[model samples]
Target: MRAHKITLAALVVAAGLSLTACQNDGDDTAATTDPSSVATTSPSAGGAGSDGSDAASPEASSGGKDTTAGAGTGEQSTSGKCRTDGLKITAIDNFIDGDPQGTVAVEMKNTSGRDCVIAGFAGVDLKTNEGTLSAERKGEPGDPYVLKNGKTIAFSVTYPLNETGGTGVRITNLVVTPPNETKSVTLPWPGKPSLPVTDGSGEPVRVGPIGSAGQGG
Candidate 1:
């Protein structure tokens, strides 16, 4: 019986050693296979990737630059004096009734291709058959006149009627100069325009200030 007990005890010790070896192997496998040791990959910062989505994506790369920055806003803007080379000057004859005076409208039209601004009065004088009739400005100049292309502004010249013994002075030509202009334009007198008196005395023949076309005398 004792010999049988000794054999059983030896078998028990061998089984215990086998169990301990199994547990040690399990621990070694777990330590070697830690999650931190596993290699991981991420997208490249240089935009070098297989998907190409980092650079090729329209929405992601659209914030690079504005191609239309500092572009012009398609419209013309200007300010300065009106050029006389682009202006057309003429006279409008509307005879005044029942008086020794007559109304002559001196019209200025802007034939220029651009916009302009004109201010102050025009320099005017009458060329008479007898001699030149030096006249003076009548009223104060109006505000700054903004003249656009194909637009017209006007001023008036008043002189005496051509009645016998009434201003015997005969008008042959009308000379006009725009405000702030060195050049002058001469308009032919349609008919014989005369002043009430032969000698230049009182405001003989007066020229009014420049005004817009829509304004009346």
Candidate 2:
């Protein structure tokens, strides 16, 4: 009877121990469990930002297109006009006071790099300290200039300078308006009127194609 009781006691103890171990294992699993909530809140890592940044874009994309044409490489040039590439109605050439009355041959260069269909005429206005002079059209019927890609066209016209005669004349504004883009070139004429080419005496300068001896009034 004593042996049987001891055996029964041992069996009970072993069963209790097994149950306890299982309970401890279940508690450990519950502790590690997560409450399903957080998802994609922030960026995982380095990703594209909202700020548009295409560092590897082609050069054409950087400079954009020049109307119908493409961007010119470093080898290309805009010629005499400071209007630069893709400029419209650019003042490529200018003759200051070739005539005593102050004649300025306005040379417009279309740096648009596009084939421009000739349309409205280009006007040249002479600005003085007094005020603005009437705009004059160059050539017959003020014919439109049909400039090809990277081409320059010059139109000569005369305008009156300031009443006060001198070598320097102030130009209030000089603009060339084309059918498409309008570009302007302006220089402050302070004392009187000075040409791109001046004399040693600092007199009125004369500029034009060779063989044209301009007379001053």
Candidate 3:
């Protein structure tokens, strides 16, 4: 009977040892694996964070919005200075026999930004195939012919056929300078002098660049 009791005690000790070993193994495994290590990826797109905000739409690259102010419409008159389009030659007329003496009419329009004057118009002449070799203005010679922007002004410059041998040859190389501002433009004439319309007229025809119209060109 004592032998049986010894066997039971031995078995009980072995069972206790086994239970303790199982608990120790469980704690060691838990320490090695970190529970706080969560995935940083987004749930919806599974996308990762980038250096900038959300991806830009295609429109952001192409056809982007323009924030700059547009150029003035032809309707608005200019102020302070003049632009190239300000002074233009609207019409060129030939009166076969308007006056007893044949006369050629050249019309000019002031489309200045503000009150402006014409300094001079010269160079090309319709009468002479070549540009006008000499040009002369009588009234306000080198004086500013003033105009409130937008109104068309006609100046009658009669070239007497009698004085110079000219028929079917009108006027050319006409330039006008303004008194108030220095900015001047080459008024568009019947034919373009340069080889190509795109080419710039040789020397800076000195009416003035806008800001300098009154003071410079």
Candidate number achieving the greatest lDDT relative to the actual structure = 1
Q: Tell how far residue 24 is off in model 1, in angstroms.
A: 65
Off by over 4 Å in 3: 1-83, 94-100, 118-127, 140-146, 162-217
Q: After superposition, how far is residue 184 of candidate 1 from its true place, in Å?
A: 0.6
Deviation in Å, model 1, residue 216 alpha carbon: 9.9
lDDT per residue as tens, model 3, 52-146: 23654456434344422233323322333434466665434343654533333444456555665444443222323434433344343344444
Instruction: Show model 1 residue runs off by greater than 4 Å.
Output: 1-77, 165-167, 212-217
Tell me the tens digit of each residue's lDDT in model 2 across 40-157.
Answer: 3233212323333643346645555563254443222332222323433333234354545554444444566565434344434456555555453333333333445555554444
RMSD of each: 15.2, 16.1, 16.3
TM-scores of the candidates in the order shown = 0.58, 0.35, 0.32
> Which pairs clash in model 2?
100-216, 167-193, 168-192, 168-193, 168-194, 169-192, 169-193, 170-189
Alpha carbon deviation, residue 48, candidate 3 (Å): 67
